[model samples]
Target: MNKSLKHLSRNLLHGVLETLWIWRDERVAARLGWYLAVATNRMPAKYLICRRTPVDVELDAGEDELWSAHREAAKVFEETFGAVRSGELRLRELQRPAKSLMDLKVELVKRMLRHCNFCRWNCRVDRGEGAKRGTCMLDKVSRVSTYFHHLGEELPIRGLRGSGTIFFTSCNMRCGFCQNGDISKDKDNGMVVDPALLAMMMWELRVEGCHNINLVGGEPTIHLHTIVEAISLLGSVQPSRDKLVYLWMMKPDALSWRRLEPAQYLYEGELNAPILWNSNMFMSLETLEILRELVDIWLPDFKFGSNACSIKLARTPWYWETVSRNHKIIYDWGEDIVIRHLVMPNHVECCTKRVLSWISDNMPDVPVNVMDQYHPDCFADPLSPDYDPKYSEIARRPTREEILEAYRFARRLGLVFESISLEKSVFGLRP
Candidate 1:
């Protein structure tokens, strides 16, 4: 592993890969590249990470960590989210008037803004006056990058009509390999719409015949006040399932559903659609509590189990403790949670193993979406002068060996998959 020897080996391997390129099959070329990298010992240093073999992976959980979501399902989760039930979860539960609900949400969100403990950073700065800020870079509120009917989500979410997606601007945990770099990194790349406008956007999406209203962002939890306010507004305007279905029946055909007649579905000015909180689980209890009633699906990224991986890629100083605690919180809530873990290049051992191990032990019933569509985008690809030596480990793509190892490890650990569509997507389609 000496530097001079490594350099010599890599040059010889590169020659072989160049010679093999004439065949012109991507998988074959990729496989050839991987074999060369392994033979040359050019794999990322982090990828070589080792852990003490577990006596029993099933037994490693903290006394409560092994507590499965299935066992806790009926007991832990309140019926608050169901249309028939009402509690502190819903405005109707408090017997508050619809207008009062919005007022109460605004009042509470303002208080939260006074000392923001929303994201994992928990930077308790006062943002009430729209003058101060935190790591998230927000002054007082949230904004939108865009809103549209997106077909590129999981099956249950996207379905036929596509998920109604609202992309919030900026992020808390800005990953180095973030695909949405244009919006996540730039604070000013998106529109500066307020909470009320966000609510209106949801209603508009419903009218457009989207399946669910999904909220995604660089990280949405950072905009606590505005998000909660918008959720409050969304709740007030939500029509019953029966109403939503009746309106849909009037549509002539599926093709006509996309360009919908809003007037037909605007009963009482209320709308109905499941709400999806597409988030990185680096959020605090305070924020989760605020949206528990309104958010129907928990679409979260349990990205890294190793602090080294997170710190190196996302610069999040406390990703492991923060995300793990948050995962436990989600499990305890007993809600519908679909955890997403994008298999990063050369990250199988250092990141994937621990993440899968933790999930297998903790939320056994929770479905994991093992995504293999991780490309070396953004800073991770080393496209230019900004590329740091530290990131050189992950600059190349992950090999077939590592990808298979991730799947094998998950299977061996008895981890339940949310979907097996990642591989299909890996080759460019989920069908």
Candidate 2:
């Protein structure tokens, strides 16, 4: 095994010991890593694989030098061998570990500060405890514009009640078709808050009987560290099986940086909640690492197959390869990822037909959600000459046939979906 893997194994072992000690089950501690892998839909052996040598890892240690932490953890692991051999320990039986989780969260915050350039921009901003301000326009505390029960989402997300939505302000991408253009454009509406406040917000949402906390935003990647910290805090408070926290990424970047901190945090924090990524799959290898270990269900939109369309609509320079490669990565990760595409008025063929063909080739098993939600928002009026009917002289929505063709194409591609409908209407959720 590589030296980094050995170090990671040691760290994981220590984490497992801490987990068992707090949960009061030694057998579960011995097999914690395996259980985590299974729960996250990752192969158990993959835990032993080393992706990259961690930049923050200390390399000056002598061969004889062993970490005092790991040595102590090993003692506990050794003591639990009888329980493991007898097969009495169960993952379902493990109790919540509150203190160990906080310690691990503090460590995660430190690590994020050390190497937290996990966004698509990779601006190399340090956002640990002491420092402030990164490329994501955020500091130590994350500002949330508004958080409440919102019914304006897909079926599974909203369920019977609604998805508890937390809107974070400011964005990495300045997209023209942004529906929440007011919040994204405004610089003052955001309120910087600590993890405890966020945890309180989550608890408030849970008390309101929300199905899940939908982390939507200006750009979730910007305030991801704070978001993850809040997740840790909330998980530590209530270890409920029903409460799921969905991290919605409307931007079609390859992966979300939110997972980088929580991969280990999920187990160490004793969190049973699922981590959902709502992304526009702009493929990146680093994102795959996060998706492989962190995400449960991947909800991504394949915006456009044609680079010209994507460049014009989303202002993305490399749109085609990003969607194609990202779709493949999500596919390789598992069959639980969902792909969606909006049928733009005149760009149906470019967005749906071409993207659907690519999805069929790369990931046919992944569900495709065909949407018909297209209205020229304020951003598209005078600013976007191409999308503006006054400038282009095409004053009409997409024909019904274009929307129907997308659904038909998805079925032809053999893509399964929870629901493939997005009715064309104004997008809003009353506060």
Candidate 3:
């Protein structure tokens, strides 16, 4: 086959395999079923659902009492979700809570800004005052490097349309081989956007038929307040009549669109895109507590196996403990998640093997994407002026043998890796 034909055939095969895997794997289906429902408008997004689940605590409640209320609210959310999933109740039937969990989260996250522990770095700088900046190099405002329908994600995430990706500026970790170094390292690279504008970006992507609102950046954990607030605003903004007409016109297949009056559509203001939290998995437990109620899916990266490697390569301390702890917490919560472990050059034994082993032992049922797309960039690029001999070990792409070995190891551990693993031909390896 010609190169173009070969590429098309490969994509077709991958799509078929992705569908088959989702159908065959009950665990994967159970984990991602809610996300798929929200994407197709069969159910409301978690954030929208959160708006209807009340928290009894007052804004002035003590921190410990507030956390206790938060936990109770999470149980309520679970019960609500169960009803919705089982068709026992419709989303429209859900009464708005007096004080919603989302509202409480918004307030709590804002309070956290006073002594920012959003990420594990614990910079403790008062970001709300703008007097000091955290290790992420971001202050009160969150910057958007770009927002668009990104087609280059995993199968279920992108779907037929694409994943609505919003790239936030600045990251907590300083990975030497960072792919998005320009946006990640430069705090001034993108336009600063408040929660309102950020919400609109999400609205636009939903209108354009994107699957999930993919919140990524150098790292999104640092901008918890902005993200939670944006989600809240997205649920309340009633689009104009013209926009509703446009939305209906764009989605001709929407059967219920005709049944609802234009006025009804205006007042029912809710965005139905699943909140996909794409992050480095270095967030604090407090941040994770808030996100548990909002985020529909977690796209966390398991970057390093050892703290030594993480500290040396990504300038992140306590990599193993932090990432592993976070992963286990999310898993124990029964959250929908897909873990990505990038196969780096010459670090397969120290990183890839260890990460896969941990996942197999702990989260074997969770879908994992053993990525082979790592390439030298940023400071690791020899051609870049920033390159140093000290980072020479990861200055090249992973060998085909290394990629194959990683896949083989994942397979040995019985990990659900086929859903997002690269094709054999991509690595020039035998199947």
Best-fitting candidate, measured by lDDT? 3
lDDT of 1 at 426: 50
Candidates in order, TM-scores: namely: 0.70, 0.62, 0.87
Model 1 scores a C-alpha lDDT of 0.61
Model 2, TM vs. native: 0.62
Cα lDDT tens digits, model 3, 59-94, are 788777878898899899999988977889877898
Candidate 2: clashing pairs of residues? 252-280, 254-282, 283-326
Residue pair clashes in candidate 1: 237-270, 237-271, 239-271, 368-418
Error of 1 at 159 (Å): 0.6
Model 3 misplaced regions, further than 4 Å = 1-27, 238-269, 423-431
Q: Roughly what TM-score does model 1 have, to 2 decimal places?
A: 0.70
lDDT, each prediction: 0.61, 0.49, 0.81
Candidate 3: residue 202 lDDT (0-100): 78
- Off-target runs (Cα >4 Å) in candidate 1 are 1-103, 235-269, 418-431
How many steric overlaps are in each model, in order? 4, 3, 0
lDDT for each residue of candidate 1 in 203-277, tens digit (9 for 90 to 100): 666666565678888877777688766765663554356544532332233234444444423322234455678
- Evaluated with TM-score, which candidate comes out highest? 3
Q: Flag regions of model 2 displaced more than 4 Å.
A: 1-89, 92-116, 126-141, 237-272, 281-294, 382-396, 422-431
Residue 11 of model 1, lDDT score: 34
